[model samples]
Target: MGWNDMQPLLVQATQETLWMVGLAALATVLLGLPLGLLLALTRRGGLLANAPVNKLVGTVVNVGRSLPFVILIVAIIPFTRWVTGTTLGWQAATVPLAVGAIPFFARLVETAVADVDGGLIEAVQAMGGGAWTVVRKALLPEALPALISALTTTVIALIGYSAMAGTVGGGGLGTLAINYGYMRFETTFMWVIAAELVVLVTLVQLVGEGLARSLDHKRPAAASRWTFRRSVPTQTSAAPEAAETAAQETELTGSALR
Candidate 1:
């Protein structure tokens, strides 16, 4: 087929991919954020430490993560149909996409939250802050960079999952590629679709990296300066004790001489 012949199909496929990815991302964030936080905060010695709960949640997350996407899609068909009222469209695709993604995203979020400094959490607690306050003001802020990176990974993974959705007539770029490139043996069409996927993945990575860098407060230059500033007061306070000691010695010597 000519380029013109493929243009409309490409547009439709792109739209379908975007719709699937966007909705899945939104759902993942909503469902995963709390689960991730819970996982991080309920581990042994964590804010809401509970070994049994943590173990259960961890097992479930691991199980979800371990399942193959194809199997997951098939396994969740009935639930997808119930939730979406159809198991064969972009909307239907989102059901499995979101379900599969939530646990994955939650684990990423847990890792990000765990990377937060323990001292920050302790500081918040010392200030009489509650769990939610500590999470909001300390954990999330401190781990913003890691969390942003995690979010990027989640989005990229969702794109891959959306491609798999094509098997069920989800009709994204994957479907277009399969229909023309595989079924019709149109090599050029396949290449075009492949190139688009690469570009999309690249763009997602670049944007995610940019956001991560922007959020990172641990850059050496700024961090070193901040550390120095924090230490200066302690150094200055010690100076007064040294000065007092010297003055007392001088006074004793003068009295002895008199």
Candidate 2:
């Protein structure tokens, strides 16, 4: 068929691809980010250090990472069928897509959060901050840029996985390429779809990189914000400024006395 005839199919496929990838990416973040945080915090010398727990989680993540996506998708077919009540279509595709991505994304997140300065964590803890406060005020904010990079990587991987899933009745550009281009021998249309995939990936990569750079560019101001928030005592936290800023003014007072 000509491009005119294939236009509708391509459009439908594109929408399906977006739907699958979007939902899968959301799931990846919801599940992966926390898993990553767990991995980071449970390591030896980490905030919640427990060797056994860290080892267990690390093993699981490693296994997840080791498995090839294509095999993982097929291997989880039963689970996918149970979850979505079907083994085909974009909706069903998300099960494996998310399953495949969570571990991968989690690893990236673990690395990102772990890369946060140890000094920051120490500073937070010295203020009598709890684990939750340390994570919120120190780890997450400081590691945000790297986390963005991790998220970008995860989304891009999801796009690729979504396309691969399409080949197995997942329903998207890959299916279109297979059904029309490869099966029907419509070489020209297949190339067009190929072009579309390239453009899609390129756009996503560019946007992600640009956002990361923007965040990096403003890191100085962001760092100042973190410092200010931590250094200053506020009325709202007067009762338990220990968790946020208990020791902040002591240095200033000591210096003034000198």
**Model 2 over residues 12-91: C-alpha lDDT tens digits?**
99999999999999999999999999999998889999999889999998787777777887899999989999988999
- Highest-scoring model, TM-score: 1
Q: List ranges where model 1 is wrong by over 4 Å.
A: 220-258
Which digits, one per residue and each the tens of the lDDT, describe model 1 over residues 1-258? 898998999998899999989999999999998899999999888999999999999999888887787788899999998999998878889888899888888987898898787999999999999999999999988888677767777887788778777866777887787778988999999999999998998677656655555456575533332433443344453255335533643453233222
- For candidate 2, what is the TM-score? 0.83
List candidate 2 segments past 4 Å from native.
217-258
Clashes in model 1: which pairs?
none
Which lDDT values do the candidates have, in the order given?
0.80, 0.79
Q: What is the lDDT of candidate 2?
A: 0.79
Lowest-sum lDDT 10-residue window in model 1: 249-258
